[model samples]
Target: MIITGEDIGKKFGKTWIFRNQNFEIQSGEITSITGKNGSGKSTLLQIIAGYLTPSQGTIYANGDQIDEQKHHSVFIGPYTEVIEEFTLKEFLNFHQQFKKPVCSIEEMANSASLPLDKMIGDFSTGMKQRTKLITAFFFENDAIFMDEPTSNLDDEGFQWWKDLLKKIDQRLVIIASNDQEEIKCCSKQLNL
Candidate 1:
């Protein structure tokens, strides 16, 4: 898969978050969007994931224009919502209805060290983050977009995140973060 952004820009009201940015991201590469706070890294990632529309220019995936409703990418971010009302098992089952995971639900739960019967609402921040990562990494998708992936993770969880990345080395992975350790794995970087 290839994602191309041509003169992409985003603005809210009178202020421009970012403008005139261009990039070409391809499969089998881990790309990091690096910038300081409020530097539009997350905004740019959202635009690429089809969660938000750019105020200017265009974004294309594999030679086709990106459509918000039809894009087949998986996104995991601080703002990405999860069904807190469902148990881990229930949530995984529900997710399976939309997209098949690369692994079984039991394997994902075990790898994340999360109890299948536990409600997502009851999980700790780190656990929830793990759940999110597991869902994103263990799913079948052409592209994966992550924003501050290590936000709530501990040292062990951080290592787990890095290890998980190794398993999906052939997929198109895009991350928006300021963490040096997290960015270390990326071969291509777009600094805002």
Candidate 2:
């Protein structure tokens, strides 16, 4: 898969967040977007993932125009919220209703070290990040977008993430982060 953004830009009201950005991201590679705070790294990632629309220009996936509703990308970010009221099992079941999981429920639960009956609201910050990462990684998708993926992770959790990243194949991975270790995983980068 190839994602091409042409002269992309985004604005909130009259304030432009980013402008005149262009790039082509292909499959089987990890790409990072880096910038100081509020430099639009997350915005660009959101636009590429089809979660946010660009105020100007267009994006294409494998030569076809990208449609947010129909796009088959998995995005995990701090701003992306899960149903805190649901148990892990309930949330997994709910998610499976829309998209079939690549792993079994038991496997996912084990991999994330999550109790099946535990409520998401009760999970620690690290646990939640683990849950989100597992959910995104366990799905078969064309693209994966991660914004500040290691925000709440501890040393062990950080290593776990690095190990997990090695297992990714073929899919296009786009990460928006400032972590040096995380940025090193990417073969290419887009600096905002």
Candidate 3:
């Protein structure tokens, strides 16, 4: 899969978060979107993920215009919403109804060191982040977009994140982060 953004820009009211941004991201590579705070890194990522529309220009996935509903892409971020009301097992089961995971629920839980019976609401911040990462990584998707992926991770969790990236290295992975360690695996950089 190849995703291309042509002269992409976003504006809120009178101020432009970013303008005239362009990029070509393809499968089997990791790309980093880097910039300081309030520099629109996350905004650009959202636009690519089809969660937000750019004020100008267009984004094409494999030559066709992007459509969130039809696209098989997963977005993982510190703030990415998960069902806190459901237990880990329940949540995974629910997710399977829509998209199948690359592994079993037990395997995912074990890999993340999360308890299947525990409610997501009760998990610590690091654990929650693990949950998000495992869910996104193990899912069958063409693209994975992450924002501040290591926000709440500890040393071990951080290593787990890196290892998981290797396992899914063939997929199109784009991350929006300022942390050098987080973006180290990226081969290409899009400086916003």
lDDT of each: 0.90, 0.88, 0.90
Tens digit per residue, CA lDDT, model 2, 1-192: 999999999999999988999999999999999999999999999889887889999999988778733656789987778888999889988888877688898898887778999999999998889888877788777789999998888888788888888888998999999989999999999998
Candidate 1: deviation at residue 73, Å? 1.3
Sorted by TM-score (best first), the order is: 3, 1, 2
Which parts of model 2 have CA positions greater than 4 angstroms off?
none
> Cα deviation of 78 in candidate 2 (Å)?
1.1
Residue pairs with colliding backbones in model 3 are none
Full candidate order by lDDT, most accurate first: 3, 1, 2
Q: Which 10 consecutive positions of candidate 1 have the poorest summed lDDT?
A: 64-73
- Positional deviation of residue 163's Cα in model 3 after best superposition, in angstroms: 0.3
User: How many clashes show up per model?
Assistant: 0, 0, 0
User: Residue 42's C-alpha lDDT in candidate 2?
Assistant: 93
Q: Give TM-scores for every candidate, taking all chains together and pairing residue i with residue i.
A: 0.96, 0.93, 0.97
Badly placed stretches (over 4 Å) of model 3 are none
**Worst 10 contiguous positions by lDDT, candidate 2:** 64-73
